[model samples]
Target: MTRLPPVRVARAATTVRTAVQGLTRRMVPPPVGVLELVSGLIEANTVYAVAKLGVADALARGPRAAADVAAELGTNPDATYRLMRAAAGYGLLHQDGDRFDLTALGRPLRSDAPDSMRAVVLMIGDPRYQSVWARLPESVTTGTAQAEAVHGVSMWELLDRDADYAATFNEAMTRLTALDWPTVAAAYDFTPFRRIVDVGGGHGRLLASMLGAAPAAEGVLFEQESLLPAAEELLREAGVLSRCRLVGGSFHDRVPDDGDLYVMRRVVHDLDDEQALALLTTVRRDMPAGATLLLLESIVPPGSGPDFAKTLDLDMLLFAGGRERTEQEYAALLDRAGLGMTRVVPTISTISLVEVRPAA
Candidate 1:
């Protein structure tokens, strides 16, 4: 038997302890699991409250007294103190005396962070989105958008009318896309293609990633006119502006038929089957033989086990009049639109790349 050094023995012991703790956690069931489910709403709303109050943003520099944070944010000191306490309990912040500081998990909440989730937090907590979620029960009962029932308009219509809300929504989408694009860019091979068209590509971030990954490929960004400035700025920042063309158009009427590859990320899930089919048909009409269509969206898995898509399906139901689809459903939808599903490529992110080509 060989004797180990004291430090090495202690490190091995610590590793074993960690492994045992992990296994134990996996083996143990939560006490009153139903209560855990019921209390999730409390945690979610508390997180939202802290996010909206900009508490994390206020503490970006260093730990601050809760009252000072509240004063800076124009919020009530007592309420802010309580909010910070709750956030600290949730491990989003650490409390010391009367000061609160962000923990590792909470640092991403700061707006200055590269991959900040602040936009996501704000967008989800906004009254416009929350109003739709509140009517989710009605959506479940009627198989239609709860927003339509409550606000007498679709989310798109609401966005069109409310510029501020629309900007927030776009920022949220950009933040999410930024997080997911690196995975998609790495998982797919875009080198063979010369031209890539991104339909409904907001800010052109994903397209920029694609273009960056495939140096030889030029890009055509097609989106609403209002998004042009932002997309141009992103493309320029990526140094791919000279290689890309920005085109403002509606996919409902027509799409550019020249590209060898077309990408629509997180777009199809905003419509019902009829509308989705219509948009697909428009693209199919212009899709030359051997061209590819890449849908970058969540593919709902077969069974239920804490899947993000399952939850997003509900959000689609209440707000966008859409639903996440299984692999078979995507195939069938593609077939109907005269496109063939070649393969579904899984990425490091939750979203998958559903690759399709014009039906022979």
Candidate 2:
């Protein structure tokens, strides 16, 4: 009824226009972010090509044209180019003239490259893991591990009993351990302790790194009986076997309580609350009066902010029935074990060190 001011009317119109623009933006697709979705699909699909063709391992010989690679591997040249082109588009590899050269990612895909992604290619491309990913939508709806549902037995149990899978599974862990070493060695200091015990130290790569970093420090590598031999060889090569002890036993059964520093890296997250509590409890019982316990893991950040480790959490849910934890979650677990949480050291962007000493 009352006459409106011209300035106010114009301002309101401007506000409405700006709001519509924002709404339009929200509805419109983003350019760079969408690239990741496309890339993820491409990587998952092409993982088969490299894993089956042994392209990653073969690349160590040197880059070759799609024609030559297809000939050596006995595949259609055009098909191989399509596959390689997909990878090249994602910066996994590059096509220089006719030859495909290793990018930063391609280098790691090589078997010779330390902590390479070759095992990743194998594991992700393998049927057991692959089938589960196909059932991801089912998991999303039901909130359960599709792997367990499809395969019947648990992922761990299946890997344990299957001879072929066991070897590949162990090798994959060893490879991941190798990938983690450079960042860990650069960031963590192992000099404070003379005797260090690595629980569930697969292939002893972590222990080797620790011992290498602290030449004066002796190490004990603990794992299942079958894994001990492999650990022994790894430690032997690192020249720490003289000082290293291989304890082929379970942490649930008993831990070697001889060391001042007891460490477990990426081990606890592969368990549910009950098993995690039990494992931590075992460590607590075996820990010396003044021993230091170092839990190497990723301390999940609060909220939905981007986190590399969070993806691994879903992986734990899918394959391992385990989980990634927030810092609060880690504290809760430590509390249950009758241990106190001390300082947590951020190792690399994707990992951290939870330093827990004896609770006074």
Candidate 3:
């Protein structure tokens, strides 16, 4: 039996989903379709509610009546049933009579699940964060982040002040990195590089994975000082602490030099063009002539078809005052920084390894 690559499977699934959406739009009245689009928030909030309420975790043991679950959770039975019914409608739960069970789709909502997404759901659906999205119109009109408008602080500042939120955000990043890093590590050959610097590496998961793959390579995990302890713990857990150096600093200020391979994963999409250029220029200045830089990012594809990057771009705009870029946009940016993009290596996940080097 032959197994298909995850990237190919993902693309096929996307194609099927697009076709289904298009067919539904063509069959439904325009007004009805638009109403469905506008009312998406209802479903989103429903999912958030169930995830927040521990409904998924409660159902993990076995199927149970909503009233029984509600009694355990100290909520109203009827409301719990209604919520569970809505979740069933969304295919996250299954209902038989009055009993509800967690579906495979909802399994990740459990904090103990192998690929848990509970933190991600809570982080995005938190009322404070959702309020920032409410100011999207203002963000679009002013072309700036709405975090300060909503929370009276920049996103980074808010994270610094709110320890719980910061922890959740870090956990979410770790979860995402867990899903993407193995594929990213396999997508490129790291064995040639003796020193690998992961700029803004969060919690050191990605860097740890690369180090495991490239036993010959020592790693530099550069991140804010506050994140160093967590990164150090993760590196130690991965058994790569001896092979890694945990550096505390801001990439905006400086990055470690002379590394043969430098990686910045999901970092550039969080900055505006000017800030991104400055950071890239710093890297270019520090990079040795023969060294390589790999930016692991979701390259926004051309055309009107659906891509998560398109939706993520809007989230970046409203939350961080940044935007996702296309291949051409990245190439131009690299050229301005005295670097040149050599190739884009696709990974099993949506992200790609964009290879670059100091310009000749």
Candidate 4:
């Protein structure tokens, strides 16, 4: 049987979820439905608690009594049972008598899982992020990032100061990239480009994958000086180090020029309109007349229906004073920067490749 494309599968799943939600709202009183929505924080924290406690890893081998898991984790037995029971209610685990087993949904919480989300859970649920989110009202009122207000520094500065938090943040980004890179590599043809430059490329994983797809193309990984060492190591492991050059600098100021294709993934979404335009202008200044700029980003759809990009837009506002944009918004931004959006190429992943060229 021919399998449906992932994009179609995702749309189908969203439709089903929307129908189920509608049914649920109809079945419950308005106040009850609203209250249920309010309790989402509890559910999110529960998942974070279990992931932090290594409960999923404890049950990786097989089902085990809650008390046994607590013993293995050196926690209070009764409390562990309650937490595991709560997790079961959330579909992360299955309870049988006093024992609990990790559900398929919970397997990704394990650190060793191929699609592990442990770092993402920990990063979002960390007290630092939570505290910044608590100030969302302030962010909305002032149209500014709350991270600076809460942490007394920008998010990037905070990352530079806290090594542990930086490591977790980097790993979370890498994990997210791992899920989309293969789809992106297959979605676009890179073989025609002799030089590929990945602007703000972190960890160099995406660049490595691109170079692998275009064996004849060399790559330039542009990032902060502090991140170049790690990117170098990853490039070396991918066996593309011989063909890749690691450049250390801020994209806001400049980027290496004369690349046949410039790729920026999830980078523009981290800036407000003015900053984003400035960055695009910097790229445009150096872009060759025939070069292409491929921006891999989640374009906000026209309607107000549920989209991960919408949620991420709010997160960006709260943390970095950035916002996700729609296709028209992107086109407008590119136009102001002397560039024109040629087309948008959809990938199996949430991100789409926005193909652009310098305006005449």
Candidate 5:
């Protein structure tokens, strides 16, 4: 399947939305419905604000007066009461007089929750990304990334220059990996490979999971210098540090040569075709003949019906100058890098395991 550009995807989404609107108009008035749709952007930002304020965390013990919550979070009392009331209206909190309590929907936003969304919310709502998203029209109009247009640099470059933002972004990614790795580990068979290398694997969570799953399989977590400590700590905590090697290097240059299986999760989508091919070429330089490579990512299905990858495609367009690709599109990319697409294994999660090998 040939991947449609972002503009076409947006047009198609609008068409689908229009059809849904027509059906909805049978009951609700069109103006009211459209206004609700328009207000969705504000609602999303409101959630972000509360998430960043750690409102759920503040209310973790019990309900508190809005003034108390505001004092705890170091914000204006009146403003906090207004936010709390709005949040209650949105089902994120429950308001009782001047007090507010966190709802189930809001609990996950707590900083200390096991499945916390605090980092995810913070990273997504980061001013850097928000400013870029504000200029999304530039991406749509110029067919280029909005991050570059707004910040005069790519999102990756911006992160590099801003250490604090980069740390938050990394935390968010780590949280996401934690959410997805269990499904991937359960779905894929990693027993055959003796040595597995995870290229660009940040903090080595997935590699740790893989190593745990395949006990006989020693692993290497290949990433930049800055990420090694966290990766090392994670591997140690997983009790697989002895079996895992932490290598600091850029995939653009080379990957470790000793692995029989190489993996990249959500890595290729960070680069354009040329950059992706270059990274793959570097992998090919080190991968032995017949070694396997797996790309675990969300595979964009054509003619989408409620697929999140379609939304992510626009994010790629705006932030990374890359794209979410269909299966055929991935096969072509693999072919360009002297790798042959062998198969794609669907997991319980939205991601798929795309298997490839060196071309014969």
Candidate 6:
């Protein structure tokens, strides 16, 4: 006699349980109510005054009277106070009588601070990016990205086709990259590799920094041909031009033929599994035996915490048609490319270096 179907068995068990115990409820935090709803929207800073005044940068060291800060920034004292007070209430600053100081939470706003978020803030606060988020509702409705709708093109295409937007975007990345690469250079070991290529290395920012940190390591920076001029200038500015070669190309087609290491920073997440694996396969095939592949990106966690990268993960979904991945997902992607995860290097609270190599 064949056994009853599993669904039928489950339904019979559920019916018996429901008869025994009428109903059940699970606990969860209640949704935000009306007052909280208004509070959330109304609190969004208008004019982003603290950023405008460079208040966070100024107060990073210690507290100062409003008059002094105003004098320092060449602003009216009373206006500065109001802005500072608004910032204080927002937890970016603390107030003591008429004096203003950096709260512990505001330390990340310091331009010189490690993993400083000022650049990120600046990019987000800009009209272009802000506008993109504003249209997110429409993006969700149509399953098309805001950038494409607003600008009449995809972000990647615009970044390549439009010189002005490319310049501004690259400038923002340059600022953030300048702040990050110094730490990455001083921390990561690059002594084993004679040649390393930074594929899809826009403006060659990371390559320049890596070369600066590892003096003996020669480098190649591969970027879109249209972006080559800017990448060359970046290398020149980095003072590593003589030590490196510039290859204007696409990662989808080819990478440097012979390199021990292929470093792609913040590139993998811009692709889905198929595209990501294709890129990985190309890198694996191109890289010499006994080589390393370092994917410098933040690893998405399994469950929700106070994940700062969550916003970017959403941006990946809306903008790139991509999303951040957990370690298990990365393992599968690597396995598909005949590579394996050797180790993970946490560079900071927000970033990690995923080390990969060919399977044995």
Candidate 3, residues 1-360, lDDT tens digits: the string is 233377777678878989998998889999999999988888888888988999988988989999999999999999999999999999999999999998899899998998888988888888988999999899899999999988899999999999999998898888898888767766688899999999999899899999988999999999999999999999999999999998899898888986999999999999999999999999988878899999999999999988888999999999999889999999999999999999998776778989999999
Expressed as tens digits, the lDDT of each residue in 145-233 for candidate 4 is 98988889999999999999999899888788877877776668999999999999999989998998899999999999999999999
Better structure of 4 and 5 per lDDT: 4
Model 6: per-residue Cα lDDT at residue 240? 92
Question: For residues 1-360, what per-residue lDDT tens digits would candidate 1 score against the true structure?
Answer: 133234345446656876775666566476645566677878878888877778889999999999999899999899899999999999999999899999988888888887699889889877777778888778888888888777778788888888898888888888898888766765689999999999999989889989988999999999999899999998999899999999998999888889999999999988888899999999999867778999998989785345678999999998888989999999999899988999998765678999989887
Q: How much is 138 displaced in model 2, in angstroms?
A: 4.0
The list of candidate 6 runs beyond 4 A from truth reads 1-49, 52-81, 91-117, 135-144, 161-164, 182-187
lDDT by residue (tens digit), candidate 5, 1-360: 233334345556666886886687657777888898888888888889998888888999989999998888899999989988998999999889999888888888899998898899899887888887787788889888888777788787887788899889989988898888766776688999999999999988889889888999999999999889988998999999999889998888889999999999999987889999998888888899979999999999777355778878888888988888899999999899999999998765668899999998
lDDT: which is higher, 1 or 3? 3
TM-score of each: 0.89, 0.85, 0.96, 0.95, 0.89, 0.74
RMSD of 4: 1.9
- Residues 1-360 of candidate 2: C-alpha lDDT, one tens digit per residue: 223334345446656876775666567578844675566766776866676676666567778897888888788889888888877877777888668877887787776785477776777778777787777677668766766787888886787778787777778877777776666665668998999999989889889989988999989888889888878888888788998888888888789988999999898998888899999888999988888999888778776644667888888778777889999898988898889888877654367789897666
Task: For each candidate in turn, give its C-alpha RMSD to the true structure in angstroms.
Answer: 6.8, 11.2, 1.8, 1.9, 6.0, 11.6
Q: What order do you get sorting by TM-score, best first?
A: 3, 4, 1, 5, 2, 6
The C-alpha lDDT values of all candidates are 0.86, 0.79, 0.90, 0.92, 0.87, 0.75
The C-alpha local distance difference test score for the whole of candidate 4 amounts to: 0.92
lDDT of 6 by residue, 191-246 (tens): 77788888888888888878876788899988888878888988998799998898
Q: Candidate 1, clashing residue pairs?
A: none
lDDT of 2 at 177: 75
Q: In candidate 3, where is summed lDDT lowest over 10 consecutive residues?
A: 1-10
User: In candidate 3, which residue pairs clash?
Assistant: none
Better of 2 and 4 by TM-score: 4
Q: Over all chains combined, what TM-score does candidate 1 have?
A: 0.89
